[model samples]
Target: MDPTDAFFTQTVVGAPFTVLLGRRRQPGGSQAEGLHINLATGESRLSQLWQEWALLSHATPPGTARTRPGRVRRLMERHALWVAVLGLLSLTGSAVSWGLLLWK
Candidate 1:
């Protein structure tokens, strides 16, 4: 299998499990153990485990499948284009500031 494909699968499936399980173990052990366990389980099983855990953790009452985003998220979603424009403008401003600083 392609290295990229393997990495992407690991990122999507194994990473979350590693993160979740990592919190429970001693700090040094967590990182090593998480990777070892996740890799040993392989992608499919890790994906299933992640999905099951996600569903359990994020469980909402039945029939409430679609919930509205929070205020900040909704604002961002609705004004994504504007946000991008503002971000670009801020970046330009910072670059100009840096140029002026270096020129001095």
Candidate 2:
């Protein structure tokens, strides 16, 4: 699979299981060792994650400003075009210089 597709899948998967956890709330199962081991640690991590998700989810569209990438890409494309042009010009200049030296 493409790296980008994998990245998107991972992004969604890593999103707090809590986002949909409420909808699928199952009755607590038998308290296994894993379940009881770090209740406080898990709760605090979830709490902090939820706060971050809330901030991101609630942020205004204007505040996000995602268009910077397109601008950066255009700049890079322009730079690439200039580099290509410069390479061709230098090659042509070298050819002319070689011809002049041969004529001498």
Candidate 3:
């Protein structure tokens, strides 16, 4: 088996991760498709949905998408702390809102 195919299949099949493939609109009125791999956890899916929307809205070239693993890792590392903080803040805000609503 090809190494690349083996890697993708292993990562996606029955693993704690998923590979999402879809098309996005390009700047010159064309469509660009890309692949995104994300964790299968609930919170990760929610975050990935938002990221997918943003990526689709401003589509990248096919080559860029295919070669984005390193870039994606770097970006996640850079924003990990801020992302965690925001996630905590959102959960706290939601819990507070729910408590207030139930109290009323």
For residues 9-65, what per-residue lDDT tens digits would candidate 2 score against the true structure?
878876433223223323463222112335666642334334565667655564566
TM-score of each: 0.42, 0.27, 0.33
Q: What's model 2's TM-score?
A: 0.27
Query: Candidate 1, TM-score vs. the true structure?
Result: 0.42
Top-down TM-score ranking: 1, 3, 2
List CA RMSD, all candidates.
17.9, 17.4, 18.8
Looking at model 1, residue 82 earns an lDDT score of 99
What is the C-alpha RMSD, rounded to one decimal, of candidate 1? Answer: 17.9
- Residue 59 of model 2: what lDDT? 54
Model 1, which residues run further than 4 Å from truth?
1-47, 50-56, 59-66
Q: For candidate 3, give the lDDT.
A: 0.65
**What is candidate 3's lDDT per residue for 1-104, written digit by digit as tens?**
89898889888874443334443334564332333345575332334445677768666655664544698789888999998999999999999999999999
